[model samples]
Target chain A: MTDAIQDEIIREFDGLEWLDKYGLLIASAKKLEPMDEDSRTDENSISGCQSKVWIQSYKRDGKLNFNLDSDAMITKGIMALLLRVVNNRYPQEIANINLYFIEEIGLKSNLSPARSNGLESIIKRIKEIAKNEALKDNV
Target chain B: MTGFAKDFPILEQKVYGKQLVYLDNAATTQKPNSVIDTISDFYRTDYSNIHRGVHYLSERSSERYEEARKKISDFIGARNPGEVTFTAGTTDSINQVARSLEPSLKGNEVLVTGVEHHSNIVPWQMAGAKPRAIEMDEDCNLLLDSIDITKKTKLIAISHVSNVLGSVNDIKKITEIAKDHDVPVLVDAAQSIQHLPLDVKDIGCDFLAASGHKMYASTGVGVLYTSDRFSDLMPAKGGGGMVDKVSLEKTTYQEPPLRYEAGTPHIAGAISMGAAIDYMQKIGLDKIEKHESDVYSYARDRLLEMDNVTVYGNTDRMCGSISFNMDQIHHYDAGLIMDKMGVAVRTGHHCAQPLMKSFAIEGTVRASFALYNTKEDVDRLIEGIEKVEMMYT
Candidate 1:
């Protein structure tokens, strides 16, 4: 996809009034098939979550593309939100984005500390994939 | 009775201009005036370092401190006071046993029950011991026949009474099974020590651990009772009074109890625990047990009468606590509704997440009782449960 198309997709999400409005974002993300066991052989396991979550990032024409899947529904929504911010960006742009900014988005603010930790784990997984890709290019 | 209630200063406080009915006794019993007074007196009048001191205050403090150990031994029917080692609480006591037994355990296998608290399970796992939880029968009693005790089985750690389910395990039978396999057993008596009459000799367990706070004593005080035959086991942390002789060259450690108690002990806690034990002794444990059983039966019968209410554990015999869930409301919501009605019940997994997972439940609201709790308190709790049901249904 072109930068304009990506910006349009990002704008559609940013234009949403409430988090619940992005149920389509969560549904589309969940609908994306999980990477098979053979594909998730290593470097895809997300820690701190009670359920299994795998995030696979691939470089398409020097831009990051992420495919995420999680067993938990809420966690899948969180992963979707994370992908909207970090996916389909250049390695440098992805690295510049601070993961802690999720608290400002106010997703699952009422969740227990344990659930919040799981959300952070998903964010960290996305960051790890970006960092690994960034390292491969010597950035 | 009002005067007795006032003796607990916490009870005197008003939450929204209403009295606090602390029904979460199985979690931790409230301190009485006598126990509190004993603690304050130790800190104010008799504050001194105990043991290995030549000063007058130290000697006096040491005498009083060690006397508390004797009192605990007598209270629990332990053969010798030397078997009683001071710990932070029940968790610390269980962890100590798990750590000290590492040398004796060659293989990874350790037997435990499904009803054990996380404190009892996690420590053994941390020691690299593989824990096999014995399955509970239809009545929620631990099925000893299901336990596959092999030569690799190093230890059997079980709870005397489950904090969540309030189901009492047959410790004597469990210990006997461990004995047949020549494996030692550690009993987590955090819940039972307060309500039940415990005799270490009769139970024949290698180790028994209990928290003083659960028995109306001060917090931060607990006891670990070990058999004399296994007294040579070393403690996890070692320093100070635990050693016999310490020099730049080498250090010699003391005997069983002293070797385990390393730092300057909780003198006030120890003394207050002695007072608490004495208080319980005066009331008679048999009477307390009978009264608690009657309370459990009454609560269970009343709770069972309500539609869409499920009570967990063996109804035929339960001790201090009753764990139950409402029709469709979350446990947290139920807890909030109960709190609003001035009825305090514990919500969530009661630190027994595995038990929750077994039943495929998120959590339960547990209403636990104590000696001070009356039938009227149970009636208030029933009313609160009804309110919770009405709100969700």
Candidate 2:
């Protein structure tokens, strides 16, 4: 897949050490907008994650935008990267986007069933929403 | 690395360009080279089913497996080898007891401490019984005097040591209380068996459950100690090996331990546990206890001295695990950063959510100790904490 954002992430993480990658992620997590109290309800929270996470989404100009936040800064940093790639995109486009930077950047542990970090669950949730929205658009 | 650390080959490597300071012993311990080789040797020399085959290999396998049982029986002061039955793990062991006593436990209460792992709490609940907690003070000491164990209380299930806080419960005292009431006690020793010298006879408990993987042995094997007094408690499971005679109309069962272990068992895993017991005994449990105490005290003292850290559970006696959190950093965030620094500490509820609820916190960062751990590892952990603080500042 040819994704400029993913390629940029890959390049940024290419020469860095493990600690440096975590440091960068912490910085990015700090930059991500914090979710408000009303939006961080039980309805928006993702289950089966060690760190608590909430997701909020809306439609704007025929595109879906998501706001994701986590109590753990490292997870929130990954959420920031995820939003940078998938947010502000049409539903059909998001349904087909391939995430390759996760493997390239040595964050594959986050994708494991054992860790259950909610990264995979959140991605699956995002895709499900995109597909459902796309079906509605067709109807 | 220290003298004992060299015995565990997994500890010899580097992680993220630093020596691996393994602080997650409460979750599972790294196996020694002796244990690894024993498992391999058993698999190569005697790989046959036990107690059924008449061949030489089967006889050898059965003898070795029985020897393993005997070693474990002696290790926990089981009085006789017939009192110990091998189950999958501690969770399985507890579930077995729950299944056997389900009829009686359906509506009765099983008194438990506030700081029990889900393994001890969930099994009784699954058996259709209510698990009421024995109240403790703010310092997490068990307040034994206040519990109202009327006719409704059938059992008292307790943990010898809390998996999260390393807080050792006064189980002997609890057992005495249970004895006065004629209520049976089941001790969950998953967190204590590896670190402390255990004697089920000395503790005077009816049942004790423990896991193998947590004690430097292979997974998929554990010991469940059942007092001879309850030998006739209906076997939790019934299959080929546990029965004396099977018939279309009725089936009679074997006596005690063999009656409990039905179907094919994890023979190699059992032998590996025996080897692990030998490995620990060779160095002596007293020596292991002394070394671990020094390291644990040093770690706890250093963590307590840090003004930004909040260490949990201040019981009179503690070991194995110490739970804490930084002033502003999330436990998960601290754990991830510490992993990068090659310090492997477990961060989360540690499978004790009720305890977490009592602490009024989501989770904690736990750095647990084992025999192989040293003051050097504690220093490295402190360094990792400092690095995390520096990055955030």
Candidate 3:
């Protein structure tokens, strides 16, 4: 079952070239203009970036919806690509998704060490949020 | 100038089929032939542990080791050889001072400038003293107006010249202010000792620390100069040669310097440092100082003439370093481009992260100079910067 889920994630990420296919998502994430506290997370709350990153998520119709922002151009593009797969998924579904599928797709080979670590950190945080939400639903 | 340049053997080596244009002197200066020969001679002829043996070789090694101490004392114009304590580098020396002096500084504040290198700032912070910062102006000069020398200020630590901005502070005046408030001052002279004429007495600083490698000497050797009056203060470490007598019950420590130097000293390092100082004296520090200042002035002026280039620090007052940025280019990218051109420059915070925070910049490309550097080197650096600006902008 885990292998099937991993294969699906690898296929999805492989279909998207990140910078070329989803250019709009990349642009929107890169040009993250300031918004009200209700619309965006505090800049101080942003984590795991050499530059600034702001991630805001809400539950819509019993599914998680994410609107992510980052000050760095390339990092924003990466976050946008990540959000495409995990956004608007059920909390349990998001928590169970495997990120190591990226390594099989050769994503880690092309990225610098710092960028790779940052991406891993962001993925871990997202998974943590999903697990918390799933636990709350069970309770 | 070419003859002097050839004296440094590293300059003769080709990097990627091009002659190396080394401008990373602030990180570490290339050793001349004389310094290399001095270390080789000591190891080849006389090799023994110092101050612990009664044999002929031991006596000779001990004399040379102690003579090196005297040479360092004279080089920095310290009052006595006893005032000079040997350490690994400026970082170690500053650590000693911070750890040893913190106990005496209870209920007192330690003032430092934002322009200090991490070595000078972090140790004091680790020592449990409240570290206050002196602000810098828009031009990166230390704003003396912001310094409030109150009685609570037990220690005032400042760098003589900023490693990133290359701005030389008036340490004498700053020390005078500290004196009026009855606070002792520690001057981090790692960058300034080579480019500026320094006299501990004239500056009136209570303690001064400098590295050997930054001033044409070998690595693993440095000096910490303390005033004789404050010799009674405790040292951070104690061991082998530092104590007069030792027993299981109690150990009595020696005088000021011996108390601070705990382990077996770097004998060959001390000898080569003396030789490096001899080479600098022969070339005349005044002449080298003027030469480096000229290089900085020429580079700063030429960099300002280029479009889409932003240079940090005051042009009118600087030593041998210039930090700048080309429009739309990351500092790491610029550094990579320069490296391909066989021009070396430091690309980072230059260990002054607080100063980078003040400028709201990630980092800047720094080109630092030395006595062996020539006008052609500066031109190569400028050309490389121009290439980076053209490529990015």
How close is every model to the real structure, measured as TM-score? 0.76, 0.98, 0.78
* Tens digits of per-residue lDDT for model 1, B281-364: 777888777777777788888998988899887734568888998875556556755776778888777889888888888678
Model 3, B18-91: lDDT tens digits are 67899998899999999999899889888799887989889888888888899889888899999999899899
In candidate 2 the C-alpha lDDT for residue B82 amounts to 96
Better of 2 and 3 by TM-score: 2
- Model 1 chain B scores worst on lDDT over the 10 consecutive residues at B1-10
Interface RMSD to the true structure, each candidate: 9.4, 0.8, 7.3
Write out the backbone clash pairs for model 2: none
Tens digit of lDDT per residue, candidate 3, span A4-69? 555764665565533232233335454554435665555434554454556667898989867665
Using TM-score, give the best candidate's number. 2
DockQ of each: 0.05, 0.84, 0.07
Candidate 3, superposed: residue stretches over 4 Å from native: A1-139, B1-3
Scored by Cα lDDT, where does model 1 land? 0.78
